[model samples]
Target chain A: MLKINDLHASVEDKAILRGINLHVKPGEVHAIMGPNGSGKSTLASVVAGKEEYEVQSGEILLDGENIDELSAEERAHKGVFLSFQYPVEIPGVSVTNFMKTAINETRKAQGLKEMPANEMLKMIRQKSELLEIDRKFLSRSLNEGFSGGEKKRNEIFQMAMLEPKLAILDETDSGLDIDALRIVANGVNKLKSEDNAVIVITHYQRLLDYIVPDFVHVLYEGRIVKSGTKELAHELEAKGYDWIKEEVGV
Target chain B: MSKYTEDDLREELKTKEYEYGFYTDIESETFPVGLNEDIVRAISKKKEEPEWMTEWRLEAFRSWQEMIEPEWANVHYEKPDFQAISYYSAPNSKPKYDSLDEVDPELLATFEKLGISLDEQKKLAGVAMDVVVDSVSVATTFKKTLAEKGIIFCSISEAIQEHPELVKKYIGTVVPQKDNFYAALNSAVFSDGSFCYIPKGVRCPMELSTYFRINQAGTGQFERTLVIADEGSYVSYLEGCTAPSRDENQLHAAVVELIALDDAEIKYSTVQNWFPGDADGKGGVFNFVTKRGLCEKNAKISWTQVETGSAVTWKYPSCVLKGDNSVGEFYSIAVTNNYQQADTGTKMVHLGNNTKSTIISKGISAGKSQNSYRGLVQVSSRAENARNFSQCDSLLMGNLCGAHTFPYIEANNKTAKIEHEATTSKIGEDQIFYCNQRGIDTEKAIALIVNGFSKEVLNKLPMEFAVEAQKLLEISLEGSVG
Candidate 1:
């Protein structure tokens, strides 16, 4: 569903992703694990077409179309989604209104009319139910004063609303407790299907136990240095990333 | 992708044109350019005012001659040449229109172009409109409906002729002749504005609105609005203005006064959209207005204004709580873009015991404009237990713009409780990216962010006016970001 060839990206003359490559097919769950500052979030942001990060010498493709020239919003219209590591706080916009605007705008970009108000409400209710979000929480300002777990869950709620084909959960498990992690992982697992894909990026292996990935890749420095199955997560959790660093002689 | 820097946003903001820049070709009988005692007398004579009114104008003119233009505002502008502007200009035909068909077609077209057709306003919005062109009120709608409820609504000139007792008792009672430099000038040579009076124990059936337009090129617009809510009465008044694009700065110095008698309530709102000149700041309106209200015992007064135009603006709508347990409120959203400068806020004076006041100000500055909020809260020694809360927030769109706050508080009463809070924030790139990633464009994202920032103040507006104000904010900031 998504392809990245020789992905070299930087921000303000500082290279972050150097010659990284990744490919993910539909219906497959891919886990990209790494220590701090290993370009995990940068890869997600680049795929989402963040303007600050310049694609120095690489290309990203979604559904066999070169999306390097598309804007972040255009990419979103074409079914690309990125769950931000830290959600922004918009003080006066309710989560429902924000979702409505996002959904309507994406529909508008595709030459469709705005979603019917009743249908939008129904979808919101269904998604919030799927994610176990409070009804009152949808009316509060977007992410303003939200707890860390609530923010992460809200990001997942948005992913469910957009129903993007390629969803990149960048550090979604960072601030979640055990219960919250189970709920978030359960929500992601239910939304999985054959026509879409999920890429989970995390620093720890605790989340893999809930939303068990089919493939695990360890990203060190700027590139993925090792690839294995679900058992590799338990292996790394028992040991540590130091063994991988030694194996890569870094 | 190409880099969309702040410089690019600044360039885009500069390219936006003022939408209401079209001039109407109407023949007008314009007074010669100059201001003196004789000119003030001539204006009073043109209105055929009573002898006392003429003497009042002369007194104001005398005070104005002695008063120099104040320069204390946080604004920089080439001082307007007062003598170079025509003091009065009215359309040639002065016949009173009995109905819409009797009005001038060209004049109706002007209102239509302004998106305020009198016929539509009367039929649809149920709003009584006093349409003022140049310095003369051309049409006053829904007068009979308002008069049915003992609500006196008409032009100031009509009110002076027909209801002199009410006009004489309240005119200049709140903002006197020597209130300030602009107030003195406006009091001296003001031509026309709306005057509304809600009778005792009566509520106005509909919104009282006045739409001021400056069509003549060189004439200065000086309008004086007076609203009086008698004992146990209630009223809501709205005022809006716009001017044609010109190469020289035109002057718009207006004075508004409100009186809320014992147990009465008054709500006054202004959506000022005067011409804001071109991108280079060549010409626009010099808006220096004085608006103040007086609240009697147990009375309440509220002022809500959304200001988005003018090259240079200096306005402060204030309330004086004179009676015990009275309330005052001020809610404002001021937007400036592309060389526009606005210094606007409100003043709350707690002279009565146990009185309260609240102020919410939102200023949005884009392009190279400068926006400032200057407010004052004063609690007198006799005002025991007076309380006031104020919040001033500013949002800047680009690096070249500026926002400033000047808050003054004076509490003499030991029991007074006053609190003030302020914040200044820029539209962060992360916020924009978040919206963009959700499929919203840059322009739509800016509109969303700004409307969010201004939701508090916008909520205070009347439902219809709130929608228009929101649209105005979006239009004012169009192309302000990539």
Candidate 2:
């Protein structure tokens, strides 16, 4: 569903991702693991078409089409979703209204009529039930004064509403407790199908315990040093990233 | 989600055009650009006012000549040439129309373009209206229904000729002739405005509204609105205005006063959408007006205004809480776009025991415009246990626009409790990105964010006006951000 080759990205003249490469196929989960500042989140951001990062030399493809020229919103309209690390707080726009606008806008971009009000409400009800979100919470302003877990859950809730083909979970599990982690991972696991995929970017293996990955790539110094099976995650958990840093020789 | 650039969106909005710029082909009697005692006398004579009214206008004219225009507001614009503006202009037709059918067809067409068609306005049936074209009232609707309830609703000119006793007792009582430069000018040569009076111990059964439009090219609009809620009475009054598009700047200086007697309550709202010049601010309305209200014992008064259209605006609607246990409220949302400049706020004076007041002001500045909220909350010594809470927030759309808050508070009572809070924020790229990531484009994102920012104040407007105000905010902020 997604492909990145020779991905060299930087922000403000400082190189972050140097010659990184990854291929995400449908019905499969890819876990990218790296220590702090090792360009793990940067990779997720680049894949989602964040404007801050400059692609010094790289190309990205979505479903075999070059997406390097697409804007963040256009990428989203083409079924790319990024769960932000720190969601913004819009004080007076309720979560429900925000979701309605997002859903309708995406539909509009695809040349579809607006969803009927009753169907929209039913969809909201079913999705909120799947995510264990309160109706009252859905009426509150988007992420304003929301707890860390609530923010992550709301992000996932939006992801569920959009049903993007390629979902990049960028540090979505760091701020969540074990219960919220279970709920979030459960939501992702349920939504996974043969036509969609997810890339979980995290520093630890905690989230992997809930949603096991098909492959694990250990990244060191902005390059994927090792690619292996799920056993590599437990191995990395046993030996910290320092061991990997030594293996890569700085 | 439009694929257009911010500049494209701005162009689309500019094409929205000053919808009221269309002129009506009608003969008008106009005065030359100058103000003197003779001009004031001529206006009064044209209205056929009684002797006392003419003398009072002359006195106001003398006071206006001695007063200097204020320059303390946080706005910069070329001072208007008052001597070059026609003081009075009226459609050379009958002053009063017995029915909507008798009104000029072109004048009625103007109202239709403004979205308050005369037929629809009358069909609403729940609202009584005083429709003023240029400087004279052409029709006062639902007079018979209002009069049956001992409620007097008519043009100020008709009020003077019919109910001289009440008009004399209230005119210039709340906002005096020498109160301010613009107020004095309005009092001197003001042509026509709405006058509403509710009897003692009666609640007005329907809404009373006045629509003011400036049709002639060079004439300014100076209307006076007075609303009196007698003892234990209640009323809600609404005023809205528009002006035709012109390259030459027009001036709108008016006075509005309200009086609430013991146990009475008055609520006044204004949706001012005068022409807000072209993108370069070549020409538009310069709105300088004074509005004030007085509350007697156990009375309450509230002012709610949504100001979105004016090249330059200087207005402050205030309240004087003179009655014990009286309440005062000011809820406003002022939007300035392109080169428009607005300096608006409210003043609350708590002079009676146990009085209270609340102020919520929201200012949105976009497109190199400047918007400011200057408010004052004063508590006198006799105002024991007086309380006031004020919240002023500003939202900036781009780096070039500006938003300022100047709050002045005076407390002399030992038991007075006052709280003031303010915040200023910008539309950050991150917020826009968040929305974009959810599939909303920058233009819709900005509109959503702005509407959210101004929701608190917009919620206070009447339903019909609230929707219109919300749409206005969206249009004003378009292309403000890229």
Interface RMSD of each: 0.9, 3.6
Q: Is the docking of candidate 2 incorrect, acceptable, medium or high quality?
A: medium
Q: For each candidate, give its TM-score against the true structure.
A: 0.98, 0.94
Q: Write the per-residue lDDT of candidate 2 for residues B405-481, one digit (tens) a residue.
A: 99999999989999999999987778888998899988788888888888888788777677877777766566443
In candidate 1, chain A reaches a TM of: 0.98
Model number 2 iRMSD: 3.6
C-alpha RMSD for every candidate: 1.2, 2.6
Candidate 2 C-alpha error for residue A34, in Å: 1.3
- The i-RMS of candidate 1 is 0.9
Q: Model 2: DockQ against the native?
A: 0.52
Q: What lDDT does candidate 1 reach at residue B319?
A: 96
Where does model 2 exceed 4 Å of error?
Answer: B1-21, B98-101, B480-482
Model 1 TM: 0.98
Candidate number of the best TM-score: 1
Superposition error at B354 for model 2 (Å): 0.9
